[model samples]
Target: MIDCAFKLQEQAFTLRVDHRLGAARTAILGPSGAGKTTFLMALAGIKRPTAGQIHVGDQVWSDSDKRIYLPTHQRDIAIVFQDSRLFPHLTAFENMHFARGAKVTTLQIRQVIEALELDAFGHLMPRQLSGGQLKRVALARALVAGRRYLFLDEPYQGLNRELKGQIMDFVDLWCRDQVEQVLITTHLMGECSHISDEFMVINGLGPTFLGPLHELVQQESSLKQLMQIGIENSLACQVIANECDFIVAQLSATQLYVAGHAKVGEQVVLKFRAEDVVIAKEACSMTSAQNRLVAKITQIHQIDGRVLIHLDAGQPIYAEITPRALSQLRLERGDDVHCLIKSMVLRVA
Candidate 1:
C-alpha cells in the first residue's frame, strides 16, 4: 500500500495533494502544467517537498513533523522520462549493465530485454537507434532498476503508435509479474485507458480528480471534453487518402470533407456543437436545412441566463435555448420538433 500527501510551492506554481494508492497499476493524468511531472518528481524523491508524508507498506520516506527526509536512492522508486537519456558513448548492451547495482540483475535484464523486444538492438550504439529503439532502451533501464513503484512522465510522448504499443506492453507485463505500483501520465486518454488499472484527472493546479477510468469516462463532464470524437455520417463517404492534420473523407451525399478518426470501413455518427443548431418552436415543412434531425423535447435547464434544451434526437442531443424563447414557445417534454443544422456546423471531430 502507498499513501502520499505533500505540498510544494515554487515561484511559478503551487501544488498540493493527498492520495492513497493500493498495490495496482495507477495513472496520473492531467493536461499540460497540471503538475503531473512535479508530482512524479516528488514521488521519485528528485524534488523534496516543503511538507509531506510519504509512506509505503512498512516504511516512511518522509515525515515533515519529524524532520525526516529520505534521498531518492532510499525511496525505491524509478522514473522514466520522455527522452531515453541513455549514454550516447555506450552500446545498448553496455548501457543496460554498466551500473551493475541496478535493482534487477542479469536474469531480470534478460527478461526485460526479451519482453521489450530489444534483443536485436542490444549490440547497437545509442546514436544508431531510432526513436523507438531509444524508448525501448530507456524502458529496459527503468525495469532493470527494479523499484517498488514506477513513475513515467509521458515516457511514450514522442513515439509513433506502433512503437508506443510495444513499450507499453512490456511495462504492463512487467507489472503483472512483479509486486509493484505504477503512476504514469499521458495526454492521449484513449490509448492510455487500456494500460491503466485506474484513471485520474488533474486539472489546473489544485484539487486532483481521482476515480476508476470507466466511471470517469461515463459520468465526468471533463472526460467528455477530453475525448477525441469519431464521426461516421449516415451517408456515403468515399474513402480518400488520410493526411496528417485531417482525414479527407468525401461525403458524396453531402459533398463535404471533415476531419475524423476512422478506419477503412467503419460506421459512425457525425458530431457537432450545440450552438451551431438553429432552434424553432413552431412547425414548418422541411426547407433547405442541409442536415435536419427530428427530436423530442425532454427537459430544459437554465445555464448562465440561457436555456440548455435537451433533445432526444433519436439519440440524445443538447441545444442552447434562451429563457425568453422557452417562455415564448411554451416548450415542454414530449413535444415533437425539427432541428435545423447547417452544414458548416458539421465537423468530423
Candidate 2:
C-alpha cells in the first residue's frame, strides 16, 4: 500500500495531495515545477511535507494528524535521482558493497551487476562510466540498500537514447522480477506510459490526477486529436489501402508506404520515429509490420544513444516505436518494406 497526501506552501507554489496508490508502479508526471520531484523527495524521506500522510507497505512515513515522521534513512527506501551522485573515488563494486553492507554476499553483488548490465563496468570508478552506467550503478546500490519501495527522481535525464532505453528496460524488468513498487517522477510521459502501471500527474497542485496510465491516455484522446506528436517532420497521409492493423499510403510520386492504418483516401496522421523511418531494402515482405515504403532515408540524428533516421514519406507521421523495432524492420536510407502497421492501431491524431 502506498498512500500520500500533502498541503504545501512554498515561495513560488503550494501543493496539496490527497491520494492513494496501491502496490504498483506509480509515476508523478508534470511540467518542470509541478511538484513531482518534491513529492518523490517527500516519499523518500528526503524532504518533509507541510501536512500529509505518507505510507508504504506497513509503515507510515508522515502523518499530519499523528505528527509522525520517519527520517530519511530510517524510512528504508531506495532513491535514484536525475543526477546520479556516485562518489568520484569509489568504483562501482565499492559503491555497491558500501550500500549493500557486509551481509550482502558476493553472489548478491554479482546478481545486481548482471541484472543492471554493469558486469564489465562494475570495477570502474564513477568517472570512467557513462551517464546511463552511472544511474544503473546508483540504482543497483540503492536496491542493495534494503529498500523495497523505490523512489526515482527523473532517472532518465541527460542520457542518450540507447542508454536511456537500456536503463528503462532494465528497470522495468528488474521491477517485475523483484515485484518492486516504484514512485517515479518524469517529464517523459511516453516512457512512463510504457513502464508505470499507474500515473500521478501533478504540478503546483490542489488536485493531482492519479489513475491507470492507459485509462488516462484514453481520456486524452480528444485533446490529442488536435495536438501533434514529436516536432519531427509531420504530414497528413491519405490511406490508400487498409489491412489487418496495416495501411498502405502513397507518400510520394515514386515512394509507396505501408503503415499501421488507412481509411481509403481519408486524411490521417502518421508518425515515423526518425529511427524507424529507415531506408528500405527494395520493397520486402519480411516483417510483422506490413507498411514498408520505397523512399530516401534523408537524414540522421545522433542525439544524447539512438540514431534518428529520417525518411521521406509524402507526409510524415511520427510513429514512436522502439529502437529495436527500427533495427528489426531493417530500414535504411533507400530501402523499403511494406510498413507493417496494423489497422486497429490507428488513432485520430
Candidate 3:
C-alpha cells in the first residue's frame, strides 16, 4: 500500500494529492499537462514534494515536516520514463548489467531478455537501436534490477498496437510473479486495462480520484476524464474453452466468444471500445455479429452530442451511439436492449 499526501508546485499549477492506493496494480490517467508525469516522479523520489508525507508499507520515503527525503536510488523502485533513458555509451546488455549490478544471476538475465524479446538487439548501442527497441531495452533493465515497485511512464507510446499488446502481456506476467506493486501511466484506457486492478485520475491540480475502473465509470466526473482518452469496456471473464476459430469465455452467466487464445480456466479481461457496440431494440436472428447480450438500460448520458448508454447484463457494460441512432431506436432508461459485438473487434487484454 502507498499512502501519500503531498503538494508540489508545477510551472502552471500546484499538484495536490491525498490518497491511499492499496491496489497491487494501479494505472494513472489524465489529459495533457495534467501533471500525470509529475505525480509519478514524486512517488519515484525523482521530485521532492513541497509538503506532507509518502509512505510505502512501513518505510517513510518522504516527510516534509521531518526533513526526511529518500533518494531515487534508495527507494527500491525501477522506473521507465517517457523517453528511453539508456546510457548513450553503453550497449543494451551492458545497461542491463549495470542496473542489476552483481546481484542478478545469469539465468535471471537470460529469462528477462527472452521475455522482452531483447536477445537480438542486446549488443546494439543506444544510438543504434530504433525507438521501439530502445523502449524494450529500458524495460529489460528495469526487470533485471528486480525492484519492489515498477513505474512505467507511457511505456508503450512508440510501439504499434500489435507490439504494444504483446509487451503489455509480458509486463503483466512479470509483475504478477515478481513485483510487489506496479504503477503505469498511459493516456489510452484500453492499453493498461488488463494489467491495472485500479485507476488513479489526475485532473489538473485538484484532488485525484482512485478506485476500480468499474466504480470509476459510474461517476460522471471520472467518466469524463476517461472518455477524453477513449472509453473502453473491460469485462472480467474466465476462459472455458479454446475452439478452432475463437476462444470461449464466461462472463457471469453470459458466454463471450473472442478472437484470442488462452488456457482453459485462466482468468482474462476482454476490452473493446464503446463505439464498437451496436444496440438494438430486439435481437436479430440473422445478424453477422458473433455475440449478442440482452441488457437493460440503467442510465443514458448525453455528452457533446453523443449518447452514452449504461447497461446491466448480469454485469455493467457501456455502449456509445450517436443521437440519430438513439432517436431512431428510441432508446430510453429502463428499456431492454440487445448489445451486438463482433468477435473480431474484441481484444483479450
Candidate 4:
C-alpha cells in the first residue's frame, strides 16, 4: 500500500494529496499544468514535499515532522520521465545495462530488448536515435532495473497508435509478472485502461478522484473531462479462440469477437469507443453486428448536448448517443437493453 499525505506549493496552486493507494496498477489523469507530474516526482523522491509524509507499506520514505527523507536512489523505484534521459555518450544497449549495473542476467536483458523491439537499435547512440526510439530505450532501462515501483510519465508520448498498443501489451505483461506496483501518468485514458486497475485524477490543485474507472466515470466533473476527450469502453476478456480473421474473447458470461490477434487463453482488454455502441430494446439477429449482449441501464448523463448511457452487461459498458436517440429509446435507469457492436470495431488493447 502507498500511503501519502503531502503538500507541494506550485507556482500557480498548492498541490495537496492525501490518499492510500493499494491498487497494484494505478493511472494518474489530469489536465495540463495540473501538477500531475509534480505529484509523481514527489512520490519518486525527485521533488521533496514541503510538508507531510510518504509511507509505502511499513517503510517511511519521507516525514517532515520526523526529519526523515530517503533519496531517490535509496527508494525501490525506477522512473521513465517524459523525456528520455539516456546517457549521451553511451549506446542504447549500454544505457540500459548501465542503469542496472549488470545486476540482471544477460538473458533477462535480452528478453526485455526483444519484447520492446529495441534489439535493432540497441547499438545506436542516444544522439543517433529517434524520439520514439529514445522513449523505448528509457522504458527498457526502467524495466531492466527490476525495481519494486515503476513510474512512467507519458511513456508512450512519441509513439504511434499501433506501436503504443504493442508496447502497452509488453509493459502490461511485464508488470503482471515482475513488478509490485506501477503508476503511470497519461492524457489518453483509454490507452492505459487495459493495464490500470485504478485511476487517480488530479485536477486544478491536486487529486480529486481516486478509484476504479467505472466509478470515476460516474463523477460529474470526471465524466465531463472524459466526454470531452471521447470516452472508451474497456472490457476485460480472455481469448477463447483465434480465428483466421478475428479472435473470440470471453467477457464474463458473454463472448466478444474482436478484430485482432491473440493466442488462445491469453488475457486481453477489448476497447471500443462509446460512440460505436448501439443500444436496442431487444436482441436483433437480422442486423450485421456480430456481437450483442443484454445489458441493464445503470446511469444516464446528458452532457454537451449528448447523452452518455452507462450499462451493466455482466461488466460495465458505456454508450454515447444523441439526445434525440435517447428520447427515441426512452432509456431509463434499470431498463434492460441490448448493446450491439460490430466485430471490426472491437480492438485488443
Q: Pick the candidate with the highest TM-score.
A: 3
lDDT of 4 by residue, 138-208 (tens): 99999999888999998888887787888888888888878898999887677554768898888754346
Report residue 248 deviation for candidate 4 (angstroms): 2.2
Clash pairs, candidate 1, are 232-268
lDDT per residue (tens digit) for residues 23-114 in model 2: 46887777778788777777777777888788876888888689888888887677877788987889997987778744456776677777
Between prediction 2 and prediction 4, the one with superior lDDT is 4
Clash pairs, model 4 backbone: none
TM-score for each candidate, following the candidate numbering: 0.62, 0.62, 0.93, 0.91
Shift of residue 297 alpha carbon in model 2, Å = 32
Q: 283-304, model 1: which lDDT tens digit per residue?
A: 5646555555577888665544
C-alpha RMSD of each candidate structure in angstroms: 9.1, 12.9, 2.0, 2.3
Task: Write the candidate numbers in order of decreasing TM-score.
Answer: 3, 4, 1, 2
Q: Residue by residue across 1-349, what tens digits does model 3's lDDT show?
A: 8999999987797889998988889999888788889998999888889999999999999999999999999999999988989999999999998899455678878878887788898998999999999988998898888898988888888887777787888888878988888898888777663758899988765667899878887787777777776778878899999998689999877798998788899998888898899998987958889889899999998876777899998878889899999999998999999999999989987
Q: Give the higher-lDDT candidate: 1 or 4.
A: 4
The global Cα lDDT (0 to 1) of model 2 is: 0.62
> Which portions of model 4 miss their true places by more than 4 Å?
101-103, 205-207, 228-230, 252-254, 282-288, 303-306
